[model samples]
Target: MDVDYVEYEDYTPDNESDNNITTELPFGSSQPSLSHVLVAINILISVIGLGGNSLVIWICLWKMKRTVITTWYLSVAVSDFLFCAFLPLEVFYMMTSHWPFGLVLCKVTSSALFLNMYSYVFLLVLISVDRCVMISFPVWSHNHRTVGKALGVVVLVWVLSALLTLPSLIFRQTTVRGSVTQCYTSYMGPSKHKAVVLTRFICGFLIPFLVIVFCSSVLCVKLRRLTIKSTKPYKVMAALILSFFICWVPYHSFVLSESDLKNHSVEVLETGLKVGTTLAAANSFISPVLYVFIGNDFKKILKRSLTSRIEEAMAEDFRTVGLNHSKSKSMEIVKS
Candidate 1:
């Protein structure tokens, strides 16, 4: 899977003759109503994601002091914002089933999706590890953690994500079949397809998921040892992890199923994929919402202006995990 608007109707070598036959609409044209609904949802996601992530980026860049946490949030916001920014192109293609944009844009837009996927997951992993290190080894974190180092990590993430996304840029092409111009990935063979899908699953989801889980477990154990009363941090961390898992697992699962197409129906897989992709797209916007609601006090969230709430959320003391009274006081002094 390319994760584009098109329904991936794979054909074996036996029927490769019919590969270019663009009979169905990009997303199940059999039912016009369902396609319209998906289009509407995608449009909504694009609007909210772009607006919310832009606000986060602005705050991180201008309204707050640059800390390691701010650097991480800013990088994640930029990645999500870029993904949302290109969603209109996808929406346009979905509605008209046309690829008027040249080949360069076709490659760029398709690759942007995977770039966001890889960068977002990699940043989450960094955040998890940073938090774990902070709690588990506060003195070292206080001594060594810096915004410059975080920026270096962010650059590494972008480089790695772009390298992983090269397949989309190379394999994606626009083709004219009859009257419709379709933008799709052309894998060389089943082995190549399997390799891409497996790489995406392992790198994009599985390994990062394991790392996050381990970090979360460590944080939970360390937090239990502390006397902190606030559950806000707990809620925020859980929401981030759960939302990423819920929104992405379906997409990855359906993509993985593409390898064993003999056991599944094409129509069902197509529908599942469309739904999964939408859910995954939704994760881009959900992070900003989480920052606003879960990162702040419920009463204050309602009373505060949006900008103030977001600023406060980003600048919140959620990062501090007090180990003991004396050490906590000393850490606060060191932070100051």
Candidate 2:
């Protein structure tokens, strides 16, 4: 869609603050209930995620640097955590019913939001390939997939992901076309209306999502074909793919539903949209928790960190969020 250039945060571009900040986009209005719910959920997730992702970084980078995979996952955790840092602003927006962080913050926050989203998704794809390669071509991968090399690939991904999300930042500007302030993506001057429509969907959501889906599918297939000898690897990969689909299917579906402009049945769209968006955001916080906590003995250690009650073992995961579990994990990897 041709994103309407509307100012959302009560800041006009001409007030000298907007100098060059863009914080507007197409056809989005405030939904108080949805925003409130999203903000609360986002804040809760962000607050906890900061700790979890930080733990992941500490473990993978400083405690367990023996494998190349650790480096890749550590980067994913950091990126996802950084994304979580901006969740509070989104929470504020939800609570206030509008963007209150001004134009520059809107741009910076939204840019980080998208960069983190796409960066992690793409990183997951890379992880899939790395796993597939390790299975299908172990010697080649071992000889080539050192931490340094993996770090380089991850760096490239960050650069590429950031570049791809640049347009989202570029097109966002808060401009007061009328009395109401709005945060929206503003397409400059006259341009092909249909082009922006297709571009927005195809480029913004569809292509990136499809990229993850396609790569994940192929990687899964490759893993399956290579691992019929044992079902465990296949099961793990299948779980990963299932997780990705569960988290992302609704997200892409919402984009598809919103594909058509002038489909002013926005209330329906917003209702449907918020559900999927929150679900996807929930996945952001849930991924590391499920992957790392379940994949390891963190729960047991955390339970020891707590009072060591039988009830506590059953409720072990709660301690990762500072619920007072006793068994703690320590990684002694790199300091710098």
Q: Count the backbone clashes (under 3 Å) in each candidate.
A: 0, 31
List ranges where model 1 is wrong by over 4 Å.
1-25, 229-231, 297-336
lDDT of each: 0.77, 0.58
lDDT (tens digit, per residue) of candidate 1 on 192-253: 66788899999999999999999999998999898777867567767877888899999999
Ten-residue stretch with the least lDDT total in model 1: 6-15
Using lDDT, give the best candidate's number.
1
Off by over 4 Å in 2: 1-34, 98-100, 176-181, 189-240, 297-336
Error of 1 at 261 (Å): 0.8
* Cα TM-score of candidate 1: 0.83
Worst 10 contiguous positions by lDDT, candidate 2: 327-336
* lDDT per residue (tens digit) for residues 1-336 in model 2: 111122222223443353233233232355555555655677778888888877667656645635666666677778878777876776655554366568887677767656766676667667767776776687998788887788888999899877767766776656453554445654342232234335544654566566656665766677556535454433444454466557657655655555452453555655566666666666556656765545443344444434344444544565666755332321111111
lDDT of 1: 0.77
